[model samples]
Target: MEYTLSPSVTIINNRQVLVSSSSPSPANDRRRRRRRRRSNGILHFPFVFSGLSLRFRSRAVVVAGAGSYGGYGSGGGSYCEFSCLNTPIEPATPAGRYLSSVLLNERKLFHDAVAETLEKLVKEVDEAYARKALTVDSSEAALHRRIAELKQQECKTSVEDVMYMLIFYKFSELRVHLVPPLSKCIYNNRLEILPSKDWELESIHSFEILEMIKEYLTFVIGWRSDFSVTESWATTKIKQANLCHIYTTSILFGYFLKSTTLRHQLEMSLADPIDDIIMNAYICRRKNLVFGHTHNKIPTSPFDGKRERENLVSYLTGFTSDSLAKCAQPNSKEALNLITKYSFALFGDVGSDKMISTSFATLKRLVLEAVAFGSFLWDSEEYVKTVYNLEEIN
Candidate 1:
């Protein structure tokens, strides 16, 4: 049997290779030019290949195009189809554009950027771990030292690091769904439940805050769950220590644990079975903590970080005005009712918790705390620090 093949085009890393008939037709050339003109600005590429004789192989020459797209996971190859897009594409935001540039670069700029940040965080965590190691007895100290050693080896490219990168990418998709009001509400509420501790107030990248919360939540979940049944003592200890590192990393990075409440679903998706156990325990222990909700609808416009900041600022203005009015009439039934509802919204139905009662005095104090938290949310800096827990970049 004999077979004939039509001309095709394959591009690898933006370099175009054209496969065509030895006797090229003027019609084909015109068609190719028209196709290229139509396919502008779209990333979708179709793959096509056909077999031919060595005689025709000589015609399979490379053609340099004026423009090209760059990315991974196309079997290291692609074929651009210059056809009208079936659906309109969403517009790009500044952050999305920046991420796309970093990601599509052949020089691996994105990986390097993330690696630099991850390394610094790991080093600080290692030093903290080392200090704790010295305070323990010889046997315990040896175990701690071993754990530190393992962490040094694994910290830069750990599963968490990969997951962090994934979360960063996912941010582009979820940016529209990032509910600042609810995020702020949940974050502040969770922090109020913690033991008395002073958090350093500093601005950090929004995604940095999200990643830190995720790491902390994963650690919290991992710490409470028992691993002795199936895993060795060293494995369990090391796992717990990693979680501790993540927790301390959150603190050291100056990332507020409260911010994760809005993005907890993303954290849950990235968590392992052991991490899930910890999350489940938290839910069982505190049934009413409302993490912000999400929906599946995609937005028409790209997520504008600037617009988000502006909206959050606008929302905080209204939140403060309303909250203050209620605070002014502290003794009114309306005030009491307002605090009770706000408390329930933030902390969930705390009816079971012995420490948190519904008394007027208790509710009043909670109302005041909400005012303080509202202030905290409004004090955000214009730009996020590249490295949290580090000196603010000018």
Candidate 2:
């Protein structure tokens, strides 16, 4: 039926029949008067009012249309109607509600908590380490003594602790001028935190270390290839441990990158050599440690695996604040530590410790040497990926 809403307004159903006349009846006139009183009066457009439904729910006008027609009437007049919705509807999705909540928080309650949290964590670790180191004089001295003691005692060590001790021990020979030693570089000497460009870019002349690393990289490139090498059993064991250190360090570095603002800033500031340093670190730390124990042969030693889960946490807790401070800076120490623990947990589940205390002790020294050599590419004069070039920083 054709419903003629007003003189200009008309709505046709499937059957061609007039529902209302052009001249208004008393009831229609009253409806028009009531609509005219409302601010949401019907628009005078034939196409708009044809199949459209405008709902006035809670005094607000809402326009809803099914379809539109091609042309207007003979008089070139178009009209629209604003109908009332008896029942108000809630939105189907929580997106609108969420947006409102976000808006509210943004206006009054939003606060960034990362920086403060990181600072707190770093302080805690530093204090703990400071306290712990008192037994052996300085932290570095104590660390070195501990390394020596561990070697003598035949005790196992965490990859991180072993890495730290090895790096500290090699600082002098590595030709890197670490200001205030480990203490200066770790906390705040952002300007000279890492080794100079020359120390990093030097070509690795250590063929034995290079050969081991190269062989491992080759194996990694062809990971699908059957794991068989013609090297001596001793060499094979060394390679396996080296591979584990590489994997462990790479994973840790990645975590550090994501966790800490300082590390991220360092990456941003010295883009070229910094990335190279991290990449080299990754390459150095690369071990055959896979995530899930899906393979036939385990990549890392049981000792390394145990260290990842059990000893690593204990080791970290000893200097947790310091390490966290280095990475998270003003925020996210607990968050980062939680992430580390979770990652370590995953590693523990997937890997087994095959490395003996002696083997574990020996590999750190090897890894230190390998890392120093491998990371030398960053010191090359020609390498120039830096923030100065991008004008991100002066």
- Give the best candidate by lDDT: 1
Which digits, one per residue and each the tens of the lDDT, describe model 1 over residues 1-394?
1111122334433422232221123443465457447955421111111110011111222111211111111223332121111101111222333433464463246545444544565565668587656857765776777676665444322322232232333322222111111112222122111111112111222443334332222222221122242321121111211212222222212211232222243233333443455455443322211111212111212222223222212222333333322222222222222222222222232223112111111111222233223222211110111222222212
| Collision pairs in model 1 | 221-278
lDDT of 2 by residue, 77-124 (tens): 321111111001111223222322332344222112212222333444
Sequence-dependent TM-score of model 1:
0.17
Task: Locate the minimum summed-lDDT window of 10 residues in model 1.
Answer: 47-56
Q: For every model in order, what is the number of clashing pairs?
A: 1, 39
The residue-level lDDT of candidate 2 at 168 comes to 24
Q: Candidate 2: where is the Cα deviation over 4 Å? A: 1-111, 119-246, 252-342, 350-394
TM-score list, all predictions: 0.17, 0.16
lDDT of candidate model 2 versus the reference: 0.26
Model 1, global lDDT: 0.27
